[model samples]
Target: MSEAATLTRTAQKTEHFDVLIVGAGIAGVGGAYHMAKERPGSSFVVLDVQETFGGTWATHKYPGIRSDSDLYTFGYSFKPWVGAPIATAEEILRYMGEVIDDNDLARHIRYKHKITKASWSSQDNLWTLEAVRTDTGEELRFTTNFLWMCQGYFRHSKGYTPEWPGMADFKGKIVHPQTWPQDLDYKGKKVVVIGSGATAATLVPNIADDCAHVTLLQRSPTYFIPGRNANELADTLRELKIDETWIHEIVRRKIVHDGAAFARRAQEEPEAVTAELLAGVRAFLGDDFDVEKHFTPRYRPWRQRIAFIPGGDLFMGIASGKASVVTDEIDRFTEKGIALKSGETLEADIIVTATGFDLAVLGDIDFSIDGKTLDFGKTVTYRGMMFTGVPNMVWVFGYFRASWTLRADMVAEFVLRLLKHMDEKHVKKVEVALREQDDNMPLLPWIDPENFNPGYLMRGMHLLPKSGDKPEWRHSQDYLAEKEAFPLIDLDDKAFVYK
Candidate 1:
């Protein structure tokens, strides 16, 4: 074919839609559903790098992969979660699938389309995206009026694994929890899980029942709360023959309130809350175990995420001698096991790094506005959704302290409201532009560093957008504050610029 024919064929591959959502995970699915319902005929497509729906759910395949928060808050608002409060990865995936099926969102999803770059053109009022097909290695292009980034905050390609000394010399199998090897058997093999985050908490109990022994080795200590996996109130309401909707609403309120109260207590009276939490750990493990040394955290409560082990499973495993905790730094990795800084050694057949995830803003998608590349750290966040001077784009950033879906649903609702207002006003472009006075306000981290000090968040703080002292410029982690502010937020506020 001639050069002109080749160019024509290439142009044919580029598709255009009213909106392009850069994920098909829970947030993406919820965003798509809300868009379809609120906008009616507005065309949109949800693209995911993975071949299936359920972003985190589909990606994480490690043993004991489950919800850190209760399903009442974690699950979408439109859907009612009738399962255990702490749901398994498969259950969460099934829930996501149900939501997609209910909304007919599968028809609008293009799987395995990994977005590489998205460039916004102010002149054309459009975003042009370049993506590569994971399976075929085919390049593709797309254009949209709006770009919704629900790709999540963490890097999906790999989990965070620290480089330990003599890693290459270790003859035993080493693995990261993010990418679990399916065929590897550890039925009678001793395993050492590194890190004391939520992933470690989940893995210890789940793997303990099968492994010869499971040891959780952490540099320091992390706060953990043991709670029931099922909601007793919901069960009571069900037995009373109450409507499912009512049950869902009641349970959701209770969970949210409980979560809020815990956060409040953690921030206001951290020492007291810390003591109470540690006391619970002592009760589970008995007076003989050194709860204060192994369970007590150096940081204040709510400063980092507190791992919740439903029904005290981790403690049970430890109590039953199936699992153990080692609070010490790794000196090095020997062929037999890991040498500790305290002159101790742990014998293990396998090492599982539950170290956590690598944070990525907008899935680290390359973004440019017109001809200029965007610097997120320099730009301020607009209500935790859009960035300053960024037009027709929304980023789904959830609450670090609460369930992720809670903030996701709120953002979706806010996005829909913005779209509706734009439609009513006949505006093609909408951007969050700070006023002169707003610019004078102190620019802080996306979340107050004091309120949230998660390792992943702290590590990637420079890559994320900033926040200001002003309400419009700040991203509030308080669910109640956002719950009231989002629906009642004035579109006519001086913060937003429309054309």
Candidate 2:
């Protein structure tokens, strides 16, 4: 029962699974769940870069960190969250753990085994993966007949380091929300929050009550509006004795379609909705606050992730003198405080960099496809899940604008379908045709952000999938439409070639 012996036994067995899943986040775990259900007795392992499961849930331990999306859509469907409409990170993480436990996936989960590189072998039609363990100098090399690249793309390991002028000089316990220090106390101390994204918004009100002075720095104005995003509707349906899965389906559809409808409106009449959104922020600020300077954003509505007052705590915090909002660019950092472009210096004891997250590509893991070094940037994403010509690989790059679970669920089903198809046809490898792909479309910012750096809110706009001629090729921000498009097992037969 020794550690090395256990590993040696595992290594000697070469425990061949039908699929090898990477990144034990929502997507990968969810996919594994579906695959387990559909194809019983099929061996698989869900691996993670971190020491624990729940990728962002486990790592992002920032104070006042909570989900932006309502828990109904955000929470897993199999498990019910009876806690509250809005959930804290701990609650969500607990929910995820429950999912793994309920499904008995804990044994299949291996953590801290970072997959550095994955290369597909054409001859064997399998993937050879290079994985390294952080704690011990242990190295693992493995191969699977099929590779499910539920490969996630968030820079979790490192914080987004903005090249702020003289930032290194004034550094007074500078912290990023992704890697918050629990020991640091902000009670009665001057705290400056620098950013306008959801993370900053969520933290401002939560921290304002404890801090002496809190200033929200905005280099560029963010689209701020007040709205309701609750799981109460889901709860009510459950009370009515409606089928829970049916309720999940309906709610998921509602959110997805609502996103699509809003996107359509933005495409049709950009200025009207944009002005209306700006007006909401203006209304929240009152007549005294400068709405034009602090609320107006450079891009139109839907171009950037809009900040919403889910609990109205942000505006309440500002009104209660607990928070202050500043719209100015950071000129540089002085020893005592930060200097803004308006020749103003704000004193601060602690600075929180809430700038935003960079769209990191799959742990920034290196890839070699058939001995060719894979340039992920040059490679166009196929259905936002599979990349063109990446044989035997199916990744889960879900929705950014809509619920994260929506596409993840569908991608799970898609993987199941493809796997079933392979088994039915007695095929080991299958390659989806690039010709079947619709490349003549705009790259959505909602998923791709290698280029979007300055504005964190707008980074995802380029990441959204292109509107294809057909639903299969299209990435619908709309939920119900996606349901019709991506059924459990209705992929285009001609699009895939069996080996």
Highest lDDT: give the candidate number: 1
Q: Tell me the alpha-carbon RMSD of every candidate.
A: 1.2, 4.3
Candidate lDDT scores, in order, read 0.90, 0.73
Candidate 1 residue runs with Cα over 4 Å from true position: 1-3
Model 1's TM-score against the true structure: 0.98
Model 2 segments beyond 4 Å from truth? 1-15, 81-83, 228-232, 235-246, 275-284, 436-478, 488-492
Per-candidate clashes come to 0, 18
Residues 403-436, candidate 1: write the lDDT tens digits: 8889999998888888888889999899988887
What local lDDT does model 2 show for residue 373? 88
